[model samples]
Target: MLEIGLTMKKLKLKESTCAICLTAMKAGQGHAIFTAECSHSFHFHCITSNVKHGNQICPVCRAKWKEIPFQNPASDISHGRQRINAVGWPRDDTWMTVLRRLPPARLDTNRHIPSLYHAQEPPIFDDDETLDQQHVIAERDVSIIDGVGDPNSVGTIEIKTYPEVSAVSRSASHDNFTVLIHLQAPVTSGRHSGSSNNAELPQMSQNSRASVDLVTVLDVSGSMAGTKLALLKRAMGFVIQNLGPSDRLSVIAFSSTARRLFPLRRMTEAGRQEALQAVNSLISNGGTNIAEGLRKSAKVIVDRKWKNSVASIILLSDGQDTYTVTSPNGTHPRADYKSLLPISIHQNRGTGCQIPVHSFGFGTDHDAASMHSISEISGGTFSFIEAEGVIQDAFAQCIGGLLSVVVQELQVKVECVHRNLHIGSIKAGSYRTSITGNARMGTVDVGDLYAEEERDFLVTINIPVDRSIDQMPLLKVGCVYREPITKDAVTLEGASQVWIQRPEIIGAQVVSMEVDRQRSRIHAAEAMAEARVAAENGDLARAVSVLESCYKSLSETASAQTGDRLCVALCAELKEMQERMANRQVYETSGRAYVLSGLSSHSWQRATARGDSTDSTSLVQAYQTPSMVDMVTRSQTMLLGNPSSHRKLRQALSFPAARPQPR
Candidate 1:
């Protein structure tokens, strides 16, 4: 898949050559040639026509275009970039805007929490200049939200969250009401893949544009010579151009060494142009030094301008740390780039601040193993862009998703008021946790809550009721999070109860289908994890048996339910997936694919699931891989942080170049 042996060279454009339009260059029509480090020539219209296509790799030599007119060390001072993509301190004072503080909340006895706000502005940006307003940073950080529809309005997925459910049973059993969550996306009726099954995907509603502080860390090394570097530039373009005026951005490029392209600045017209120029001037050479780039990223991220913004770092790397240097003084031991992993995470995890580093591994040459671990430990998401073109899509999706965040740093606490009840499990967002300390308390760290993104979490509780026929409170849920717009702390609480019945009656209530679906997903994920472990240990038989048996059992259960078409197909897919495990095909990909897919697949096993329909409602476009089908959609919005790594099926799963969906 890798086209190698090409060197960066000079371009001598002839009238008959074109890289993009594939036609001859015309006189006076102009032509564009990447003359610095590449010899690709094309029609000017054909070449410059596309900015963020992620296809900037030279067609003739497969060389990626280096940003034009690379800045010298001294000359970069004027551009506010310390080195490559990193930002330097600005000379102007326009960026010193003030942020206003919120007033007291009005009391309302009817609602326990009283009033929060009409709309919270992003605390990072400034609406006024010079002096700090009622506070620091921005005066009034108002966000503009257009009409957005729920993904459920058209999606086949059925996500149901039960605050409380009936616990009445004829038999005298433990009566406990646990929070039930379900994410069901039916697929059978939409098996006609050629047609647009827009209904199969959820359209996110509640479009709100908020400010963000994003620092892009790029790997412009020899390994990233071709399409990798090209796509990264294209993706960076997507992120920079679509940034809100209040957003703060910086760029960092690293190969043998690291360089900051620009200093952290607001996304005004000048700032955007400067940032794009930096992106355009980048070139691939030397070797990878990821830690160096990350270190520079930390420098740009700590800026006061982005203090209240939804801040994060985007890292694009194709290889491991292939280059390290010894200390010049000879008094100190040489440093390993791998050792910088913890240091990089610690940089953002200082005090009360955290800068989630969304990392992307480019291709076969990429160091995905380390990159993904960094993302997980740092509480940031990980992604891989297969080869080329998908880079821009990944960026668009990631930025778009970050922009659509409804709340950040979600901390959920679950407590039980009822006696003799033990919490079995608690699911929140994409992660599920079990209560450890006491049956009374459990906590879940939900990273981000997206607009119209319904994450149905289930809390399974085991109740041992001897014989109390009275009704009582069973469960309590508490949530603490920063307001999406204002970045102020907010707490929300809710409680649910259940009734116990006589133990010796007939006809016990059937558990909700949604609950069963979620439970099934958990079991499937366990199987996948186990299978992965087995395969890694060279126990091919065990791995195959694990997946195959789980698939068979799932199929039997699904067959009992209506609409087995999708289920049957999934079972077949599982069979194929099981074979993949036996042959060692998909081990390197995401370990949580089963969990993410189960969120959708098991929903069909539940009743009240939607039948396929035709309703196209556009909403927030966040790149998420639920299954192979949804995975293919990754190409369109490819927002950089994709964790899965499918090697052989790259073309089938990869997305096209991306564009921003306006909020």
Candidate 2:
């Protein structure tokens, strides 16, 4: 339920406040306020903006509004976003909006199965029924393990029982594994419901169908060559073979420009074969222009039909891009290949397409960092391959990622039993819990839990529940799903029983991992830069130090391939710099090359101009490491293109009047 009222002044909220930190808003601080049918008030800013662009709901109250009513640009300019929420509509286009139109919550209409109960009884066992055939209900059981001191306890599965709907979701491995999940509520009455226990609910209730649109962007760059292209083709065949008939797939291959290998097509054996053959025909040629590929892929997914699906792109590449706007001398101007893809992805997702992207870096030359960012921006995955042989597996992994997105942009709203009760923040991911003691206490297990065949995904929710014991005990869960295209929202309500409270311990494991990964990448990039600078300044020791630092940091990264590549690249660059440092010491004397040290190039030039031949031998005698002649030859390899600098040092050795110009 939603209510909209023109506010002459400020709108006040009830017990509910900001989702980031549940607290009362201070005076003069502005926030969008929402009032639900239950008279629950929530700060509008807390729910709308705190969430992504497409999601619009009162996070505290679980009320949903529409978006089309507030599409007027003038109204937006005058009243701002506050008006959009007040009107019960999406303020802007986003993936969250698309998920909102999905099916609403529905209960199984079938007969009531026995609610298993064991107040204080021995272990209960039910093995006659299979997962597919058995109807789950609220129950408790304890198992006694032979030779063990204590019995192992298992909690009951209280799933709203429904008739099994046959569903065949495409598996990433191209295996023939398919299962149906509940999708719609069947009509049932008390007496009739009890009698018709076999009536099953639709797999994937209409509310959770999760409309999706997927686009495949394949790299046809020449570097992909024979084997890489063949593997990619085979992997693609597997992907098509595994998809559910209801799902859609599109393929786009790119070299310098994008070309559709197959327009948006439904999953069919014949269709899959045609697409596979098209992929095989895709000969690798020309340069890699990723921007063009993305634009074309976006155009296909933006269609109204694909909007029913979550828009997505799968990029396969084997090397870095070559042609693009570049400033050779600008600070960090090597073209942000990784940053560019995310920008494109975000823009498309904002336009009624919650399109996530997954990347398969097919070979060592590809930019792995860029692939990862592209995946993150679109809410997808990234994988690195060492050889063409792994292409099929890589493709399968990408398919798995797509299959895992059972739900998109799922937001949870929680209400506490007490007004003062504060709910701690919840991270995104699937959670598992056990109802204990006739009362229920909720303990969330956060992380991806694979469904029988679906891919894994990360999910987070902000619930209005208390973390500490000094507040309300009961916890209520509510949620809203934003449609990827329509910008509509479907609200849902759920709850857990109350029992003896047990503290749940969660560590900062993911946070630490992210930090470490970031630090290592930054360190490696900087160390390489520093080494180059040190060599330019003729500081061999500093150059060596920078390389060593980079080498150590790379070793600490999780992936050996990433670390090894950085180590190898930096070591080679450092070696060149070290050689230059040695050669810069050569000076001229008596028209013959002479080994020298300690004297700055400037000093050497000044001394030679004054005909001070004595300084040449003196400089040489100062260091016993190597002769000036020997250093000159060694440095030639290091400073091959730095002719001006090389000439100056050699001139200084003989005439003491030459100095190389700075590069």
Candidate 3:
């Protein structure tokens, strides 16, 4: 028997003696006996099947076996506490030991980052004179965001490629290229996250003449009494510092009830001092009322002064919204606090405002699910501060030190009308997508790509091996978006051809190692999936071995290709997963952690988006917290009593049901 600390000699069983069923016993996710206290043991399949058929009584003893505890003189830990604790896997020697096998998190910023792009020299293409033409087709599919919003906001969509992968494939077979549909902008990190801030945010407007109206909602619950509150106010100073002369400011403080420090007003010297005084006078006393705080902030945005201004709500909270635990889903309002979405939605219609909520989750005790859902549903950004100590850091990350911060919603769609080749599927890191048009088209929720920040989707094209490639246009990729400053519809298109020839004659060469670097997450995901089938079939050893092997192969591939960012994600997640499998943490019930892994791919990228940063691997660990998945799993009452159902394989071509969507 698979053992943890149980000392009882395992009961020997015949192949035909399953305690739940009268049939033979099998091995895998849940394949064993349930010997609690009985002389005539029954098949586990028989017992469980009978119980589900409304027979809790043991067939042999006719006793109440439903709630009985099973043990062999000693019992394995309950499923809930299997190999983890409240915060997740114990942060001990075992965890650290697993981390040591991977490459160093990151090299010195100067060395790995600057030199990282040094290899990106322009390819000497003979000439663009012979290139094929692609038709420019722009379609404004749908606008989820309402109102005639942000006049100054313009969006520009560029379908471009890195210099390395820009060349048309002239090789005879197995040729590939990556075209990036830059939805928004490349994401950067906090001031010190090692980012040089290169990518410009396309349509998120930062109009100099437009007045800024930002309302910061602060949580002054008892939990914020000591160091938390002090650091919180200090962080608020950064927001105040970012305000321009024409900018407006408002502060909404909430504990049991909400109260505005000042009415919606422009930020002047006197106004700044008054806001500062209110922040200093703030004290902690009542329960957390984040809902009320957000509700009040919404009102501040509705005031006349905010019309046509750069409006936003900076929501900071260190606890769950008052009594919000009873809410069905954080997407809707509850008795404790108002749901931010209803207000955001109500305000987005007609003359109402369309301000984005920038949420900061502070302290270890904060409710991440609620915060994340609120930010996502309300079309705002969410950030986890880790602790009160990093208040300033979180503020800088969520709001930034830039004189102006622009926010916009981005949507991308790829269509394949060609008969020979078609786009199979798109893996948009952690973004959410809906497949429509009979698999011929897909719409991606790219959210907001912050200034100097970038997001990408992988286009998997189904190519025919036997098809003749006679310089025919194989794929035509295009992008449609509104420009950032002009608010005009901007669309771009690019085309590439296919030619059948031997690889050597075309003088094929290795290009930038950084091309398609984000694919590392996708590759590891593929490998992890392969290992899961083996584990569910009672081959735990094979599962661990396969996963470990996949990790090493990925590590080698990333290293040889110089996929620095992708390498970090692979090493960090693969090793951690290997440890989990080895310790039997990923037992029978759940074959793999795809839902969590899917969410993590984006989190890891966000953490390392800035150059010279590797701590994001740890961020990936947090995103895939064993408990995090368990919480989401248990949230659905259907899986509460039936734990094994979580292992059901999702449709092969479908996206993960649960996605960590960022606004």
lDDT of 2 by residue, 1-663 (tens): 323331222444333333222345443465444443323343544333334433333222223333311222233335344423332333332111221332322323452323122122112211111111111110011112221332221111111111111121211111211111111111111101111211221122212223234678888899976556645654665566545444567777888766765556545444444444455456789988766677667667654332343457888777665554346664321345455553546523213444656666665566544554455455454554443443444454344434433333443333444343333332222123333322222233211111111111111112233445432233454444442212344455552212122234323322222223323433444554465456546665676677666666566565333433323433433343334344343111111111011111111111101111322111211111111222222222111112222212212223111111111
Q: How well does candidate 1 score on lDDT at residue 550?
A: 81
Which lDDT tens digits does candidate 1 get at residues 39-154?
44444323322322234333333333434221122333466633211111111101101222223223233423211122242334232112213222332332222213322121
**Best-fitting candidate, scored by lDDT:** 1
Candidate 2 residue runs with Cα over 4 Å from true position? 1-212, 304-308, 325-327, 330-344, 347-352, 415-418, 421-476, 482-494, 497-663
- TM-score for each of the candidates: 0.62, 0.39, 0.52
Q: Candidate 1, 399: how far from true, in Å?
A: 1.1
Off by over 4 Å in 1: 1-41, 44-178, 181-208, 303-306, 323-339, 342-352, 427-437, 470-472, 495-504, 558-560, 564-663
- For model 3, the stretches where C-alpha displacement exceeds 4 angstroms are 1-158, 162-212, 302-305, 308-310, 327-356, 379-381, 401-407, 430-442, 465-468, 483-485, 493-516, 523-553, 558-563, 573-663
Best by TM-score: 1
Q: Among all windows of ten consecutive residues in candidate 1, which has the lowest summed lDDT?
A: 607-616
Give Cα-based local distance difference scores for all models.
0.48, 0.38, 0.44
Worst 10 residues of 2 by lDDT: 133-142
Ranking by TM-score: 1, 3, 2
